[model samples]
Target: MNTTSQPSTADRAFNLSTWLVDRHVEEGRGDVVAIRCGGESHTYRDVLDHVERVATGLRAIGVRSEERVAMVMLDSVEFIATFLGALRIGAIPLLTNPLLPGRDLGVIIADSRARVLVISHERAASLDDIRAGASEIEHVITSDGWADFTASDEDGAAYDTWIDSPGFWLCTSGTTGMPKLAMHTHGDVKATFDTYATQVLGITANDRCFSVGPMFHAYGLGNSLTFPFAAGASTILEPTRPPTPQLVADIVTTEKPTLFFCIPTFLAALTNSDLPDDTFASVRYGVSAAESLPAETFTRFLERFGVTILDGIGSTEMLHIFVSNTPDAHRPGTTGRAVPGYEARVVDPDGNDVADDEPGQLVMRGESSASGYWCRSAQSRATFEGEWTRTGDLYTRSADGFLTYLGRSDDMLRVGGEWVSPAEVEGTLIEHASVLEAAVVGERDSSDIVRPIAFVIAAPGATVDDEELTAWCRDRLAGYKRPKRYEIVTELPKTATGKIQRYKLRR
Candidate 1:
């Protein structure tokens, strides 16, 4: 990672949107590019304009500092503008996946108690049936105006003159229970860019950052949006799901992005797909997070694209990644050393620190740790032991402080009362020649005995029967830990942020 410090003047005040405004005026190089469908390009100035109008419209509609604003929209330019606009006026934006079932969305809306709801045009039309989904929401805004607003601005509500303090509220993708909104002050996001962009990414005015992840997640919000703006760089906004290899390759060819951020699955798909030779030629850095990077994915990415996929571990509560591996320091399977100013440790269930090379719950303490979660005092309190956040995910620390991700606390299975990490099983399974991707979940049998059921996604043009894959696991894993059954699948379900939703498989 680049650690060169550039001199910067301390702002007497800080706001997330103001960062973009400052860049648009003084440092924006104008050559930075982001590509969307049909290869549409957006300049820094254009993005600034959109954010300004959205902020103005929101202010006119009564949004203010610390107010909760719920957003249910796809990946689009409007999503970015509305999100930043909410932050501009100090309104906390709570983002949820638009694809969530109506019942789930209703539960989230009710739990968040958002004062305002912003929906994309397409989403608005589809959600008409659930009009009163958020009873607490007083104002409703849409990309294509549904009520009194229009896509085109008419009221000369001066947006540039409106000023306010900035704050944000976002939900954590909890493995269980309803998601909780994490409270963040205005300075939180700005501080994120300072640490990640200036210190880690080494972003520059000329760099074009391409984010293939959802902006609703912290990875997309900070790494893709806020960090790039901090460096006066540009971003391409695509209002869609994971860009197919053809579309991603096309975007790369058209935009010539300098920095790319995605997860291992997408990277694997890109490497396996029929992308053109020069598709990733201009990229200087590539980052992978949200899930552990498979060793094979790392090797394929480097061999095919000539760009090292720097993997990291981060949580929504921290705002962005706290630990990462750079190209030079990267050990393919490890999550790498902790970022500067952050400390991490592996602790047993009793909260005692464990020795190196031993697996335990990962705990972290850092400047970027969130203040608290909204309305969920009990859950929030459980997250900390003093100031250290108990990351429910399990991990192993090496002698050099490199962290290797295990599975979630809930996902870890027990065989004869002994803990069995699914990640260890899946990693070993994927190492088999016939396997491409694998997920393991506990299956209960007639005797109330829980054993692992492996779901394997085989490599294209490769054939592996379920019985054969089960035997392969038997050879690699311990007798008690080996999969009791195997199921072949085309693909596994994942969250918008690319995390495998193992709970979905449990059902």
Candidate 2:
């Protein structure tokens, strides 16, 4: 097992805030564009100046060490400045999706006891009710006047002595109920870049990173923000929600990024779009995570864009992708071998290793794994055991070391004493020409036995009937593995990160 201990004092002395901010200025790259948004570009020097001003503003507002500052703002230079500024002043920043409903946002704010809520003007209008419910939020900072608030010339507190303290919190994409806050230290941030970003992805200073995922999520936090800055590379930030296929294509064409970070849904959409072959001409690598990329999506994207999308699996707890397919050694259907500095295994419920090719829970240990969930002791203990974090994902490992993602362990189905992976069935369903997306859930039949049911979204201008889809699956899947029924839907319910909420489908 690869166990990570608390960072030594010497290790903690190298603060990520300094590495990402001051180092670039010293390297004479201050004038280079660090972030490009809609019509505005911020140089490294410009970003560092904002970070210092925001840090001073945060301290002036009485935000202290280890205080939680909840942020619900769009992706922009201001958002990055606020996050790094909180770190500079020894406060922990909790990044939250701005589009979340008021009730959900209230739950997060109340649970984290955030001293301040940083939000955009559009989102702030609807938060009056949420703020009323969240007693811990003492102040609200809107983006309309965000720049005015950070007009201070002070550099705030020096973080050199407090780098070991908790730095940030990411809310887990709870498959169940309310999301839990996962705590990470500054050391954890550096470790993610060293292991996953530098070692696995091999990002360099020349790479221009573009991401389709929101920075609030773990995947984006690591790939789009942390990794690029750690490598001294520039990133393109979109100020709105994840873009559509045409918009993404346009951004790639205009930005000419070398590294494109995305997820399966976006890949599928791009594959089905009318983008020309040269859309991704400048992109050296495309990466996918947050969910498994279907083999069909993988192949279609390769054929259309002539660039491989490396699929991987990760969680907010792990900070970033621990097991992944690198640019050179990617397999079409499997998330490749474990990255350097991580250990992984497929284990049964008893914690014993399962035979290769047998489906089992994936447990892993790595340096970048979060300390644990904040304020949820019982849940934290259940998830973070000593060195190993039991990822709720189920997978099967091949003899050669590639890992094939099945489905969430809770989403696994036992039908007629046989196991069924919803992802497998869903992947097969999407192979049909008319299906744009598919989700599977286990439902109880009239005989009180579990059965697989499928929800499908048809392709544009394509008509799909229940009988035809069922017959199509009958030829590909085993008799017992086939879905008992198929329902055509206009769209699949998805989280902000683009992951299908199968639990909602079950409900």
Candidate 3:
């Protein structure tokens, strides 16, 4: 394939956007429906046209190849177009959760040194605050104002980027409000599509896919955008943040998707809903990730909806799921074997493989692994050791190679499928004038899912109002990271070194 001109099957250079969006149009799939969102349908040709215009628009705004374009927009047609358009010209799109507060978003933008940012309309008010700290951001555009960036001539020169050039960056697994940014190459995108998406999903052009996970997340990126476009299939995108069960039911009933992607919390919500069993009749396979799926939830969903949920584990470092349960090898309790192109191993602290049934760190290596965290040399070295990337989750693999999750190796809690750092939460709690000290720990809720609970000691002569404290944290932390219940205790158990005994708090 030639890199200097339009990408084709005969070209030597590989660009993920061309392969995902433009190639479909060039390969006689122009008329095929590519995406369905907000009561609007776009064909491969239509999406490609938007991609071209966005690419030209970026160039007109002086965005060069390899520069980072930050996106804090929800799932929509504008998002797909801008993301692919940035890729079409070799500009890397940095994905940040749209729901994150301005403080957290500022950390990501400052760390990434992104000069361009695209946000949804609802986030416009935070623009002044977001731009204050991140001086690197020179231009900010709203999601709906994408057409304003376009030029009269949509034709633009595609950058001659190497296959291994950085294509995108994903912000994830942060211990602080700020976290590590995982940078993936263009090859990583296609590698995931060719490996996990094809082998595990068995996706075809005839299928329509929908996901409850947000598109900014790695799980949703693969489910709603990457796999569908690469396989010439159609995708159903939900613009509403945390779409209600009724909304999902409506889409499934009307759009008739063959594949459904979801997380554990949303799956449980749907299972507990009063929606008819046949609501999911059109779905062939359901995919779950971002957190370990409970067996009871899996059983209830399948029995109620008649859709088999394939549970898997993936990370921002690896791009997408590397270990998954397939229809042929079904396991409700355990995360199935390694994907065809990936390898998984449970290793001790010494980096040697551990025996089956012995809980150890889960490490994996695959074609989709990111280059490393941007500007985080220590963490990148700790995570990406030679070939394997440490997942930071403790698990036990059976002799037959089925992996079962135990818990996080660190004090981090997987609440609602998002990592919540106890240290971060505790720090936020103590910031309140009413709290002299605070210790946060994860406890199983009534649903048998993990959530954070905090033990706080009020300052001398200070009042601790649960409602007032809750509102304080609400203003400071992200929604998921906030403690669910605050325990106003007179004292907290501590070690001889004066360290807060988180284990005691857990009990």
**lDDT scores of the candidates, listed in order:** 0.75, 0.86, 0.82
- lDDT by residue (330-370, candidate 1, tens digit) is 89888888877678989998989999988899998876677
In model 3, residue pairs whose N, Cα or C atoms come closer than 3 Å (at least 3 residues apart or on different chains), thus clashing, are 1-11, 1-12, 2-11
Q: Which parts of model 3 are misplaced by more than 4 Å?
A: 1-12, 152-154, 175-177, 412-507
Q: By TM-score, how accurate is candidate 3?
A: 0.81
Q: Which stretches of candidate 1 lie over 4 Å from their true place?
A: 1-12, 26-38, 146-166
TM-score of each: 0.89, 0.96, 0.81
Backbone collisions counted per model: 3, 0, 3
User: Candidate 2 lDDT, tens digit per residue, 84-187?
Assistant: 98888788899887888877888888899997988878787668766866788888888888777887666565566445578899998856667899999888
Better of 1 and 2 by lDDT: 2
Clashing pairs in 2: none
Q: 257 in model 3: Cα distance from truth in Å?
A: 0.9
lDDT of 3 by residue, 1-507 (tens): 656865554354778888887788778999999999877899999988888888888887788889999998888888898899898889999988777678778878988999999888878888877887788998888866766776547456567766787799998744322567999998897889888888998889999999988788788899899999989999999888758889999999999999999876567668766899999998999998876676666787888999899998888899899999998986876788899999999998898999998878899989889999999999999999888899987788998999887656776688888767565566566656676667778888889988788888776578899998889889988988888898999877642112344666776
